[model samples]
Target chain A: MKLTTLAKTVAAAAIAMPLMTAAASAYELVIPTLDYRTGAYAPNGIPFANGFTDYLTLLNNRDGGINGVMIKHVACETAYNTKQGVECYENTKNTEPSGALVYQPLSTGITYQLIPKSAVDKIPVFSMGYGRTSAANGTVFPWIFNFPATYWDQATVFVQYIGDKEGGMDKLKGKKIALVYHNSAYGKEPIRTLQKMSAKYGFSLLLLPVDHPGQEQKATWLQIRRERPDWTLMWGWGVMNQVAIKEAASIRYPMDHFIGVWWSGSENDVEPAGMAANGYLSGAFHAPGDKFPLHDEIKKYVYDKNQGTGERERIGEVLYNRGLVAAVWTVEAIRKAMEIHGTKEVRGEQVRDGFEALDVSEARLKELGLPGFTYAVKITCANHQGPGKVALQQWNAKAKQWKIVTKFYEPLSDITGPLIAEDSAQYAKENGITPRSCN
Target chain B: MSPDFLFFLEIIVSGLMAGVMYSLVALGFVLIFKASGIFNFAQGVLCLFAALALYDFIAPGGWVDRWFGFTLPVWLGIIMTAGVMVIVAWLIERLVLRYLVNQAPIILFMATIGLAYVLEGMGDILFGSDVKPLDIGLPQGASDYMLDTFGLYVEKLEIVAAFVAAALVAVLAVFFQKTRIGRALRAVADDHQAALSVGISLRTIWVIVWSVAGIVAMVAGIMWGSKSGVQFSLSLIALKALPVLILGGFTSVPGAIIGGLIIGVGEKLAEIYVGPLFGGAIENWFAYMLALAFLLVRPQGLFGEKIIERV
Candidate 1:
């Protein structure tokens, strides 16, 4: 055991040698990834970490590192633990010329921890789609970003999808919609938005929270069975997702009406349930499958060169693709930062500006070879979440794939707008930060 | 008949079924604690390690396929897994536990906790962190007859787990009652010095007892892993059976069983009936609270040996 510890110490030092030296350099843009590759969340987390790291490698190999300057990416494993995630942040936050370009704390709890720290350090924390939804109001949360769609945006869009199917929004009146959420800050993020929407649509909403590491949810599911809700939308992660799907199947619930947030929809979540989890729909920003043009690029340049990160096959899984999307945005923000600052090497603060001004148009999507894969994303000075949009996808059991089956649902900023303003304003007031207008 | 009453009945029935597996896990802790005065904290993680090994044996994943070249059949795979567990038990005794013998019981207990961390890390390295489905052709899904007949709505797997737990208990009972080694174990449990003098080697008994616990842990791993997935959380849930240990009593086998059922049933009912008033998810701590309350009243547990230290 001592030998093993010594070996691990030597191995860690060997891995850290580059970053330690790289911190003194001034040429490359260093993005330190506080990722969870080893712990309870690793099964779901490994692919995301792999995809994130692989994208950086792919850029270095295929494009000679995000234009001329190489992208130096370092990962410190947090094991999906908040303390370790924060520790990773503090340890790796210092990288060369200015500071670590940006930190993406994938776990929401870790993201929450880093929010104030990043603002203080002037380092942007990109939470992608699963952090505090109120962070969308860029006026208040200038350093924090949860772009594309927040959990609130997801709830409303899910309602829209259900409305689209049932003729219209008015048709949802008096309908019972259950939200089986994982009981956490991440899980509870959607309730307020959902409650507001439920009132507007006249739909009855049931909130059933499954505690952390949700393995024993027999009682929760049994409640679902008795209530017989018209639709059940799950906000779950890890083992909770798989268990919920299986329990839903066992209760003979119609798989079509039972939808889950993107996190709840993955190969890991559904494959175990086999045919029972068929037709289980979920909201997604990016399509699943490795058939994308960039995947071919990733395959040829990355895996073919034997520079891949994880199982060669899991390159385009739901979360893996989400990781790819996250990396693309992070790099895109840096590029915008470079363009705005008119310099090859930009610091952490400049990257925040780049993120605000960054836009992924339909033409740009075509240029990036991700056309029709996702919608044109645009971030403004005031709205950090961009055009918060997500489409629906369903699990095809026979083929074992997540196939996007709907066009992007427009985000209902009308409901989410006021909530964000109120929440962000409250946050700003509590923190004693004079809000930026950005006009 | 009101639907509420029927649903209540359903909850209780399902809770008992879930409790059966908890009893299986608690049973392992009981066996080890009864024979040796050490609280084996790694009993939970043993479930995880055993399950992972069983999965690797049954389904030779990428790493196994690279070297071994073939997957063992289910029955054969189980035997191989049991063999691996026996080696693990032997190693634990020879390496760690052997050194701690005659030390304070609390010291021995703390050593097992340390062992759990070491074994957890080892488990992660050996069997990667990915969640593997432990489908050894174990029955899953709801029982059609139960669902159709009385709206009982019980999982087929839970029923299988209950029967498996019952069979394990019966076998364990016969082993301790009739077998010479079992007699040796009981003799050691009564008084280590007296048993040592009667031609029973203490080292051999410790190894045997730990091996039995390991086998019990292996069975639990299969039962629970097949229900959920063979992942880190399996070990974590296995730890949850701790509350069952206190309720059942440290030295009582039958106590573990009854305590497991009471806690399981109690918690499920609490979550279903009382959870809503408190905003739900009461099941998580409900069992521990019940155990804590029960322990206050009956310190010896449901069937625990009375602790009467002679002055």
Candidate 2:
């Protein structure tokens, strides 16, 4: 029995040693994407997932796999459920050939639970747009990276946009602003930021939350009508977007004054309302409409090759472009990680470093066929977010397209940073987690 | 408080429209329950499926495009949707619901739940995961002719909805009170065994009732699909009819409409005046609470006849 136990251990070590050696030489990186391909959010989720998958395929086909090391990605559908997302995380953490370098769980609820697990597993989570706003502080969340912007960042940009439109910040004083948000962690992430800004700007912030599977909002909008808010910031998802627009239009609320979060702006949302969505503006991380050079290349190389991820026509829609940009960010992070590690076989720790070390400048973005798109992103020990700058786009009736009007603006970091630290500290203390030492 | 008062009136009007939609859905539920003595939980999914079918028919490069070599117009597509609903109703009667005719209501209800999952899966596979706007050519602009003194701005669609709902209810009422099939349906609803013994074919009654319910579901689907666009989330809206059914009694037609209006208006007022005192979004739980409270008081609902079973 002892001999057999020893032999089994030896065999296991022998099997593992060669694979480890092969991993070092081969330079293979594996990324697990938690996708919601079939659920209430599936309409938006599927296109994004497809764009993400297509970009990796494009890299493999065009660049010969990120400096000759093939990039592998496996998508496990979460349907936007937290339990299923966590299960997918546990199932794909350690697999053959490589360990998971990073995980991007799109759902904020799942991200909250995975933040602690990421520390124990040494795998960083890339919550590009959706997750805990408090995790923007790298000091508290060492293993989590919420790059580009957090929900708070988006909220600040939105409030600033409203202020600018209404003449100045002073004009916002005494003006009522309604926040009609989804009743979930993802939806509520912006409330604290809005509250802070409301206090500073002297705007009366009215809170309205719509329940999940948000189809019925007659009551919520009725409240909006009562408040007679000058502007409304909608943080809705899926069917809620269309419902909100319709209800607002029904009550004769000016659709132009109603702004939505990034998630709320999509072809699906506007197409339902048709001309009713003419003046509605939304906060955007990536430019929408299928006119970008990268999208043109995708159409030529990918869709023309009959290897397209979805309907060829939907290539440049809001959600599709967002997906493609998300993929580009993921790949860029991998490339940075590989560059620092001096090898292609980058592990989870290396990927985390890659995320932290990401320096995608305007030149780099232009080189990648994404010009006038985004700014330089730098993640540090203290700041997980690189920079929060979002452009405002409006739906044009004559052109039948989304036109960007406002240039990028930075979020209220001075207020948001302290709030993030305070919340993160509270979270750590409650969960018995020790704050990571950056020094 | 002028704006607040105006908002209050607006909520009541919109809430009444919402009630119309819920009643249309509840009409289907009551039809099935009266005929088969079984609650069809799958009714909600059926509404979603029908709406999705209508969207696909009108959408560019859809089945109509493949089959007919071109996209059909919206009105024609709607006609095709009606045809599709009929076929689906026939199929349901032939395949699953027919077999469970003599089963206990609990078993039949469970079967409907299973059917709901099946329909939801089929919808996802058939339509692809994308929300499509339901375009029914309904007037979308708000009515400028408002009673300025009362702070009321009624939408043209709301007025159309009220007229259409009233017309449908009146038509159905007259049909049931005057038509031969309507009489047979009522007879069957009262005692299926006795109706069968008296030479009323149970199969015919089941098929007819299901077909009528299918048509009712399509009307509900069209109104809602036009409002929110035809997305999978419409199924959840269909589920709101359950509370309507509880308040109105599963066998009452007028009760369904009146109960839907009361629930809708009540929830809206509650959320506005009372919801903030605790927290916002009280509308989510208010419907269920109202239904539970009503059940405790009336037991058999506003219109349901009391059934005293002998031990």
Candidate 3:
């Protein structure tokens, strides 16, 4: 028995020795990705994970690793669960050598849990487009960033779009709007903004919440039918989005009148409903489809070399492109960190500075091979959310493509500004945080 | 009828239809538990696997197209999937059930939980982890005729699902009551050793029962998948069935159906009438609450056989 045990230990050492050596040999910029590749949400999670990982791989292959320093992407699967996400964060936050530079949780629930920890750990949490909206207040949430737009910004954009559809903002009076949302922190993020808008515009706001996994929404749609709201808005994710679109179609609700948040606007959400998903609108920050020059580069450097993270055909889906955009911002931020610190090796605090000082202009975007893909994002110490501009995209179900129908429009900062202040102030009081002064 | 009464009626109608869908998933559980005396936690994953297989066979540019170079007809794809499920059932009996003959029920249940993860992982590896639209010519969209006549909204897909569930129940009832193998299955469920002494093959009976459960899972998967695309969330519909099982009894087929109806209508009414008071989203917990209350009063359930143990 001792001989057999000794042999087994020897074999295990033989297997792990090479891997340990490879890990120890390189001094790379470590970015921990808390991804969900399996579970009920895997249908949506898989593509985004692929997009994020593939773009990082593109940097490794094409540019020879972010100005000569290799990027060591340590991915931990969370399966879209809050507990698992926190575990992933704890496990990868202090990886060997330089520790984790930044974290993109890709989940709102996980972001909420990590917000307090991030301040202590000083590891910046960049939840692109989906996290605590008040984290936009950079003073209170110095280590947290949700750039391009937050849920509050998207809600205001949706209200403005509805008003525009009705000819003018004054016409919104007496109009009824229903919000079908997932029953979670992520879905509830937009309710306050919509309520303030409804009260200001004289419209009735109806809130309907769907539980997790969200396969059954018959009751919610029945309510929508009875109310006959002038417009319906949804803040849903994963299967909830698909089920809501299908239910809306079943109730014969005009698809054109229904809108979803950016998280809800994806090919996986609409294709399930078939032709009925046509004309369904959703708030978007970036262009969909794989027509950009980055696609060709990724194909040449990643797929041709057989190192692609996902299938070749799934290049430019909405979520995939969103992941690409996320990777783009992350890489640019890393470059900014290197420039600021005057070294290739940087830590979490340095990356936090990089995120705060990010300035991805249109000319910079064109240089990065994603021209006109999205609006410019300029982050500052006082403003981590950037200009909260969102565009509306319509699903052409027959063609299986999303077309950007409106130009990028700004959010209602006049309303979101005060709400952010109030919410952040309350949060600061509860958490005993002293809001930092930028000026 | 008044507009308020009409709205109430509409909710009831919708609830009843939705209940039928839940009953379909619950039926798979009832079958496995009744025959094997083991609560198969993998039943939900089985439905997901079956649906993924059926989609792979029937979908354009799927496994069938990639490998065989031809798109399979819907009927043929279903039959092929049924064959695959039968093989899976046979393998499960041979590998897992055969070794654990006369094991404790909890042990068997734990084995099934392990089996669920294995099958989920295998399904992901076989069929890519992406949402695939499943269209087996099932009628979708709201029923215009019902809306036009009664001012009520009902989905055509739900109506078809109701018919399919009813038909499946009728067929299962006959299969269990009339067939010789059904008699053997009952004997095995009663006493494994006694059935073994009588020359009945326990392995064969177990395989047959699992195959039937697998086929039921396929039907439930198709119905639910047709409504809301074939995806991983399709497995979660089994969660909606737990209340139905608790209310109806795990071993009673008719109880599964009736319990589904009650839970469905009960949750819908609660969500519509009482949800507003709680800030909405009461549908998720309403059924479980009702089931808990029912369990306190009748632990054996509405149709479950009463247990009497001698001290």
User: In terms of lDDT, which candidate is strongest?
Assistant: 3
- Every prediction's TM-score for the first chain? 0.93, 0.92, 0.94
Docking class of 3: medium
Each candidate's DockQ:
0.62, 0.62, 0.73
Q: DockQ rank, highest first?
A: 3, 2, 1
Q: Which regions of candidate 3 fall more than 4 Å away from where they truly are?
A: A1-26
TM-score, every prediction: 0.95, 0.92, 0.96
Candidate 1, residue A146: Cα displacement in angstroms equals 0.5
Better of 1 and 2 by lDDT: 1
Per-residue error for A312 in candidate 1, Å, reads 0.7
Deviating ranges (above 4 Å) for candidate 2: A1-28, B1-7, B66-69, B73-75, B147-150
For all predictions in the order shown, the interface RMSD in Å is 1.0, 1.8, 0.7
RMSD of each: 5.8, 5.8, 4.8
Best by TM-score: 3
Candidate 2, residues B1-311, lDDT tens digits: the string is 57666666787887887788788889889888887787988888888888888878887756777688787788888788878878877887898887987888899889888988888889899876688777677776466666344667566666677777788889889878899989999999888989999999988888888787877888888887777777777777766898888898888889889989988888878887888886688876888899889999987788876767889
lDDT of 2 by residue, A1-439 (tens): 7999999999999999999988676656687889887767788788888787777777776777777778777789898889999999999999646799889887898998899899999999988888987787787788898878888889988888899989998999999999999998888888888899988999999999888877878778767766789999999888889888877877778978999998888777777777778888888877877766787778777777888878888887887777787778878888898899897778888888888788888888888888876677777777887788887888775566887778888887877877888899998899887877777
